[model samples]
Target: MNPARAPQSVPARLAQIALYGVAAAAVAGLVALIVSAVLNGSLTRSGTADALGWGALILGFLSGAVAYSQSGQSRIESTMRARLGEGYRAPGLPWPQILAPLIGAGILSAIVFALN
Candidate 1:
């Protein structure tokens, strides 16, 4: 049995693709939000608003990514456990680590948008 040629299971491949898709969605959503803010003039010419908007966009994306990652991991773990007839525990992302930064960025972006 060649380790390199080991057959990959469909469920594992699907789980991996789902994780990647979630990450791509998060990044795309962030970019879209930032672009929309800029186009709507919600960000000012001083660059401060732009920075704030970007910050918020990134924070929100991170938050969402962490959440989705954990959810996907849980689903994968559950499916694997069920198939293998064993208990599984998947580690979740550290959401608290990004919460404060996200809240601050959100507030800053709101203020900037309000002033614009």
Candidate 2:
């Protein structure tokens, strides 16, 4: 095995991908809802609900992914470096460093999108 590549079980990789998928879906759904609301001039209630829903969903997913990734013997940093290449850091609190900003940015974007 390559030194740069860490050995991971198939199930683990699948789970990671699934987590990403869920996050993406949550973000996408929120965007769709916001767009619909904007088009229909219902931004007040619908936008707030969509933003809150997306934020909660994203936070939950981040927490779960961090927990799951950190459950094994290997630390998240090492796994991320191996999988994502060098300079990878797990996100703060409950996220794998690298994913923290991405997740935050996505949620923020959703909020802005809804507001606009």
lDDT of all the models against the reference?
0.62, 0.59
Report the lDDT tens digits of candidate 1 across residue range 73-108. Answer: 889888988899997777666545435445545565
Model 1 Cα shift for residue 44 (angstroms): 8.0
Model 2: per-residue Cα lDDT over 1-116, one tens digit each: 78659877887865675567456646655675676577767756656656556664655566567666665435656686787767654543543443543555466556656665
Candidate 1 lDDT score at position 106: 56
Best by TM-score: 1
Each model's TM-score, in the order given?
A: 0.48, 0.34
Model 2: lDDT to the true structure: 0.59
What would the TM-score be for candidate 2 when compared with the true structure? Answer: 0.34
- Residue 63: error of model 2 in Å? 26
User: Candidate 1: which pairs clash?
Assistant: none
Residue 50 error for model 2, in Å?
14
